[model samples]
Target chain A: MNHSVVSMDATMIQTKGLTRHFTVKKETVEAVRGIDLHVRRGELVALLGPNGAGKSTTLRMLTTLLPPTSGTAEVAGHDVVREQAAVRHRIGYIGQGNGAGHTQRGRDELVIQGRCYGMGRKAARARADELISALGLETVADRTVSTLSGGQRRRLDIAMGLIHAPDLLFLDEPSTGLDPQNRANLQEQILNLHTEYGTTVVLTTHYLDEADSMAERVIVVDHGRVIADDSPTQLKRDHAGDRITLTAGHTDDARRVADRARRSAGAEVTQSGTSVEIRVLGAPQLLPGLLVDLANDGVTVTGAEVARPTMDDVFLNLTGRSLREGGAEPADAGADGGADGGARAAADADGRTTQNQEIAA
Target chain B: MSTTVAARETNTALTGTAGPNRRRPSLLHDTGTVFVRELLPVLRNPFSVVFTMVQPLVFLGLFGPLLSDFPGTGEGSALQWFVPGIVVMSCLFSGAFTGSNLLFELQTGSHERMLVTPLRRSALLIGRALKEIVPMVMQTVIIVAVCMPFGFELHLAGAALAVLILAVMAVGIGALSYSLALASKDQDWLFWTIQQTLLFPFLLLAGILLPLDNGPGWLRTLGDINPLTYVVDACRLLFNGEIAAAGVLQGAGAAAFLAALGLLVGIRSMRHST
Candidate 1:
């Protein structure tokens, strides 16, 4: 057996041109298209994408749950395909659905998960107990998993994934079905664990706020390819600009403001009736100056507000479609339709949109 | 939130391996772990154990008296010939349907959780199949005990050998069921269709409920090709205290072949399940 040493700052995940295709009905559907990723240890990254954008497929490949149709991936310093057992030992995975048997108790599931990782019986018991308390599952730990509420079950799932204290962890849509309160609670628990253990976490989520609030880095995916990768702050600044909307007393004034706003460098100006909206990189600083310029031009500004850019705005700027729409590009949708007679692609997009609405609600 | 305490404890528990030298348990250890997990649900609900025996008991009670006076049942008592056949029948019904639990696991993603662990791939199938032995033994004991009052004598040594043969057959059937479940994926209809479709043919051809000698030549020929027929014949011979019968060796050979083929296909499917 060959043993490869891993340094503290070593890359936890590395993939080059990683791709996967699925044959839905004799016609191939390219789920992931040539994804290249490099994640260092201790980095909390979120793969931000709508449903069917292949985020889960990518996570599956990284966790060795699904073999990539083509390309290479090394997770935890072992090839995902060639050294699956080695990769499995070094990482933990919490898939999209509940991972515990319905009839088993949460505590028993945790212990069994530990035992699967080769822990001794005594050690497994001790670890299960510790996780039961740490994840606030002490009360529900003895009950059958099916009896637990969604929040409790999701927490138990997290505890199961962390039983062996893996150096790297993968979560697929961790908060998709969760209500706002439970989603916030789960996010806090995940963040706390990541911060305390310095465990590298790569979670996939279509919840824009989740990726913006919890992850240090967000990788935006669209049409099975990465469109942008940066911190939430940087992505907002680069892809989307803050908006400054001003309403004048008359249409002539709004038109004059739009004309002047266009003269400013890199500011996009649009006018509708008596309102002029200006999109600029720095709306806060530019708002005050623009107000003074309008005052000097003898144009009375009745209303003025600066709105900060959101993750949705960033996605819209990059893809020309709202993330909430479950944007499967028209061209890609047509291609999928042409290949499989349109029903599958249409239903898939509709299903994703419904799920996105649930998360949004 | 106790996060710090949990984190510190986890570090100690995992034993910071600086390299790929993490300690993995042997195959036997992993199989034992999986076996315990699979058995816990059955142990918790003891009623299920008896519930599964209801059908076999029904067959024995309603059908055994009718076979008592039938001609050409060989030299042994009809109960002796019928009891072993019921035991084999119980193994068939229970073992062949064990895959339903696996299918449920696949749908719930519990099996996927096990897959991501360091447990050997073969251990997953082996441990699950091994769990079938416990209930199988219990049912066999109950059937024999129920018939003892009806003048069915117990040959302890021969019955033990008969149980060993049934256990082997059970493992093979369980593995094959699990493989079918995997092949069917999450399609509940496909799993049931295949299991139900093949089960009746196997049962009828094996002639567990009747002797094949009185049947048409084509039926007898079909029974000759049925592996379960040999297994049932072996069980009857063993239960009759004929430990050295030629049928005993042939039944064991058929059982060994089934076990080997089942494991080969099962492990292949498990490895390629992703």
Candidate 2:
């Protein structure tokens, strides 16, 4: 009811060369190298990275939790450095861990959060009641925070942040420790929050599918800088294409099928025995044609399945390394690199894929 | 804690509507809210309430009476002189230990959560400082009340001054302790080391246990330097309603100065903290 509509393209966050360096053990660790990023109003952006990536650091800087060692970032239309109070007023932040007092009841915590944002007693009470019901926390609202389960505690944390009804919310690894069922439940709740309030959400997650499913735009961060930023579909399309596999009744038939698929523009086909693997951009549309030609050529197409790429594939294709390995493989080259010139060449290929995505956008 | 996602159907009114300007929570209100939150644990937990009150009570019951007959205790009488010291001791101990709550908050990530809010940084520290004051006053009252049953004479204005001095001492020490916690959020050992070590010097030099009248020259010199000495001296005189006494006035001045110092350190540490 108190919503104030903002322009569609108005910037919600803008950063120029935002960087942070940490001195650990008397040695400099460039946690966040230079990374320039922008997010428009109402966009749900995910900062996806492996464990050591600076995604959390970037979120901390934007939320006014940590000061950027260098560069500038303006969040929610307020400069993070000089105008933290102003930025804090318009946004809610839920960190990776629980943020409420241990023994306090969930309702009391929410009410206190509301009061901290300057709400009057009756109004804060009403708001706490509204939040308890909105987040489906009525069951746990009366329980002490220490007694609630992880998922319930996470929801209560979100309730605390939302008590003031911020326009923009920052969540750091929101679903990291939850079971699959609880993780899915929390995602649904977050989505509901975004849809109902029209809030601009910025969350960080390492899970491939979580980012792909929840974020409208995913910012792939590695080594403290933004390596790629685009929609999940666009990222997969440009970095890794669809995989189409076809099997025939005979090795000769498979060879024939591969020969024909190879003739199609940009179709990379490999033949072995009775099976043929085809990598192409538009697999669904070409699948029918490929099957027909093979049938007309006396090759019985016994099996066919097309698979799509995931965020992991995008990471592998971009860094020539796997995020599952903690992104520790040097970008330039290794066993995981290029798919050939080692790791370094593979890393370059990943960089090119990111450039292509930027160009396409 | 069991993982209980209640079967209550998924639609309700928990979604909030308060906006940035829907209400500007006043600074005073925010501080009060945080203060109340800090006070709840103390009241709810029997162990905490008992522990906070027991030490001073023991000192007053066992230590004060034992020292009432010690030699060279001066003309003020042992109980008369010792009560003021105990009062100051209560403030220092309660206020300083109150910071352990801050240390707990830091460990639990609640401190960081509070930082991200619109609540003022100063308010967070001030709220906790204010919470410490309540117990400090309560314990001081109990200490004073116990001394009354011991034939200890009372000066109405002096007793009031003593209570006020206790609060000032608490605020100052609590602020300093909180600052130390903020500086190193997780190194609780460091806080304990300082708490266990630095406090004895202040307590002993302030002459809480016995009169320092005939102590070595160095001990008396240190007492003169410690703010507690003036406070203890003033509290002793004020309890007799010696309002015009210079020592009473000096103790008030010292208490005010220490409160200001503690607050300065507290606010500076908090403002500059992450």
Candidate 3:
């Protein structure tokens, strides 16, 4: 299929220069700056960023929970600013917190929420049962949400958001607190939801692996603006630095071979205790040659491995700061006092990298 | 929690998932949804039910008899003179309790979820207000039952029905109080500050537990203008079966004024919240 042709007919969400800002204590913070984005129907777009990168704020605006400071956005063909009600009708937003009430039983709460959205009592009850089974919540459906584990509570939150069957879904940090297994389960569920319901999903996360494994497109934001948008493979080939870590049988042997390896590979090599680290571009393909040379020189190599670049590398390349370093630039980047400036920038940059990776692939 | 596509597909088939054929939910429908949800939590909370009913009964027990001997407390017994007060006060307190839940929901992000739903925004406040009203009425019934032991007689000649009507009006005022509190975003401290500043003049002017007739001329006029004073006056007449024509006018006016005020505030706040 022609990609642009399909995309033109499948625009489930589009935003142009969408902006939001807030002024606290006489200091203006621009959370979301001028930016353009598009998500096709049934597409799972991962928005990756560090904390305070305007991810939550962007979701809030898209879901109609917060008004945009300035800009135009349309979700499901409804204007976010002029037709907020219409936008709301088509989207389900699962916020950052565990949204389910701890005091109420999961089933009871779901039924009540369904009714609040105008479902008949009998219909709501039936929907509750179905969701409970679907989300694997049957065992604890009748129990208070407070008793559910972190993963279960998170699933319940997703269930509550989905009860209304909105066409577009927004999940902000859905797996932030989940264990690895639970996070994987959530990723599968999100993928299945997209296939089954044809729902367009936009989720924000701090985990690059999660973004790589799930999102069809990735958007990275930093300093309140988009820096990269691409697919995983293209980003890895284009912006990621090559990684080479070697462990030798002896520390002295590793040190003796490190300078020669750097001279041969023409890369920056550093030592960490018994292991040597080599960071280079296109170095993975050169590992065999390097290993052969090491053997000829009579240096015993216990272990050697080469790794391609990651979102972490892409992040460091663009922002000169690791994702763990709070992903923020200077405060001046958020001069408009928008809560989502940072998040939106991170999401946009991630998207760009993911797009680049896909192109390269 | 692991999820499967088959399960979601089955549920979608059963519930009629959103599509081109789906009808956009109307405002009335959305409000009804919010109203039902709000009532469910309140009805299920035993603590709220017990507190609402028991607190007023205690007041009737401790003070009703003592006030019977006081001049100008026209009634069959001490408890009878205070039955109407118990009903109004109980409804007001219950309404305040309901307001606290709304605040809690907002702070906890429950309200934020609702805002993103297809439901009408007004449903948030209106539904909550109605929830508070139902329990307030139920508490009024329980307190009236307890009042009967202390010679709390009701004029069986249709006059008892008048007191019930007063209870409804009091509930409306209470709803207004809760809606206002929610508008402040659970900033109960700010509410308390305002409450403290307005306390004395409001109490003296409204004459909630006392008669406006006992105040100075200007103060009496102020009390007459106060909605609660009129509510108190009407309760006295209706409970005693001394339903004078003027009593009906005074009570009806107060109730109408309160109902209108509450509705206005609730609607306006819900409309512009986000």
Q: How far is candidate 1 from the true structure (C-alpha RMSD, Å)?
A: 5.1
Model 1, range A1-361, lDDT digits (tens) per residue? 1224456447889999998766553445677789999999889999998777778778888988778889999998899999998899988899877899998888888888888887777778887887776677888998889999887888888888888878788998999788787787678777876886688899999989899999999999865689999999999999999999999999999999998889888999999999998999988888888889989999999999999999999998887778877655543445644444243343233322222222223
Candidate 3: CAPRI quality band: acceptable
Model 2 over residues B22-108: C-alpha lDDT tens digits? 455677876897898787766666356547667767877887767656785556567777777777887888777877878877777
Who wins the lDDT comparison?
1
lDDT of 2 by residue, A1-361 (tens): 4434334447889999998765433434566778899888788999988766778778888988778889999887789999888888888899877888887788888878887887777888898887776667778888778899887888888878887778788998899888998887778777776776578899999899999999999999876778899999999988888889998888988888899999888888998888899988889998998888877887888999998888988998887778876654456654543232222222222322222222223
The candidate maximizing TM-score is 1
The positional error of residue A29 in candidate 1, measured at the CA in angstroms, is 2.5
Chain B of candidate 1 achieves a TM-score of 0.91
Query: Candidate 1's error at A357, in angstroms?
Result: 31
Compared with the true structure, the alpha-carbon lDDT of candidate 2 equals: 0.77
Q: Where is the poorest 10-residue window by lDDT in model 1 chain A?
A: A351-360
TM-score of chain A of 1: 0.90
For residues A1-361, write the lDDT of model 3, one tens digit per residue: 1122224567888899988665433335566776688888888888887776767767777887667779988887778878887777567788776666656678888887776556677877777777777777889988877789988888788888877776678998888889898887788777877876667889999898888888888898755567788886677656776888888888887996696677864587898767998887778677888888888888888888888787888887777678765546543445543444444444433432222222223
What is the descending TM-score order? 1, 2, 3
